[model samples]
Target: MEEDSMDYTVFLEAKQLRKQAEDDAKLLSNRLALLRMEEQKALKKIEETRRKAQEIMEARIRNQELLKEKEEKERLKQEEERLKLLEIQNTKAQDRMQREQRVEGCKAKNRYEAKELKEKMQENLEIAERKKQEELEIKTNMKNQIKTQKSLAQEKRRLMNEAKKAQAREELERRIREQEQIRRNYEDSVSRMEQEELELIQRLQNTQLMQQSVYEDLEEAMRS
Candidate 1:
């Protein structure tokens, strides 16, 4: 009976050791499963972060493209405005030049008319002087031919009649006065025309200066 009790004690010790080892193995397996689950969750979080970063980068690139496009549109609009302004300035300058040319032409025409008038007046004066000289020569020849009293008396009577009839000197003086009046009138007209032309040129210059000032203001505004 002693030997049998010893054997039974040994058997009981062995069985308890086996049961403890099995419980330890079960705990280790559970810990390993939990660690795997945590690793998977971390991997998923990393993938989500990476995807968000990629989306943000793409959005930034798209925004940059949009900004570039907007800038290009603004530049084109400014260029168009500049071209329009240039065209306006060129047109105004052309109009001013044409007006100046017309003013010069008018001045030339006035000068030509005045010259023609002067020449006509001088020609008339010369003709009147020539006729008076011819009449004086004839009168002197007739006076030399008187040789008798009767002839002299007849010549005197003729001379008296001619003196009463001939108003050449008066007519000549009247024509001279008329020529002087015409010259004065022409000079007055020329003065008036010149004054009017000067006023017109001044007005044109003032308008040009105003337009230039306006253009400069527009340029300043655009720059600002």
Candidate 2:
């Protein structure tokens, strides 16, 4: 009886241990299932976070490209403005140079005209002095002849008249030739002065036309 009871107790203990092991196995399985579900949720969260990060990165890159493009446009605009300002400065400088050249040319021409007028006045004075000397010599010769005595003077006068008439005719002819030469020289001087004035007018007109052309070109460029 004691041996049978001992065997029965041992069997019962074995059965209880088996039941406890089975319960522990089931609890472990439930924990493993719950851990798997949590792992899947973590994976989904990681994927969402990675997607959001990729989107953020793409947006940052796009923004950088836009910023660089804006900067480039701003730089190009500034460069164009600088070139325009430089061109304007160059044009103004050229205009000033042309104006100075015109002023200098006019001053030189005025000086030349004044010099020519002075020389013409000197020539006229010389011509008048020469004519006055010729008249004085004729008056002195007539006075000396009148002082000679009556009978001797009459015989001398008849001989003198014949020679005097021939000399008078020659003098008149020479005087006429000199008068014609003086008239020709006066006419030529007048014609030359007229031509020089015409040339000066033409040059002024040409300069004005050139200035107009430059202004028109500048206007066109500004419009463009």
What TM-score, over all chains together, does every model reach? 0.22, 0.22
What overall lDDT, based on C-alpha atoms, would model 1 receive against the true structure? 0.67
- Evaluate residue 60 in candidate 1 and report its C-alpha lDDT on the 0 to 100 scale: 74
Question: Which 10-residue window in model 1 sums to the lowest lDDT?
Answer: 168-177
Query: Candidate 1 has which clashing residue pairs, if any?
Result: none
Clashes of each: 0, 0
Task: Candidate 2: give its CA RMSD in angstroms.
Answer: 61.4
Q: How accurate is candidate 2 locally (lDDT)?
A: 0.68
How accurate locally is residue 25 in candidate 1, as Cα lDDT from 0 to 100? 50
Q: Please, what is the whole-model Cα lDDT of each candidate in the order they appear?
A: 0.67, 0.68
Writing each residue's lDDT as its tens digit, candidate 1 over 44-152 gives 5555555555666677789989989999999999999999999998999999999999999999999999999999999999999999999999998777766566677
Position 186, candidate 1: lDDT: 53
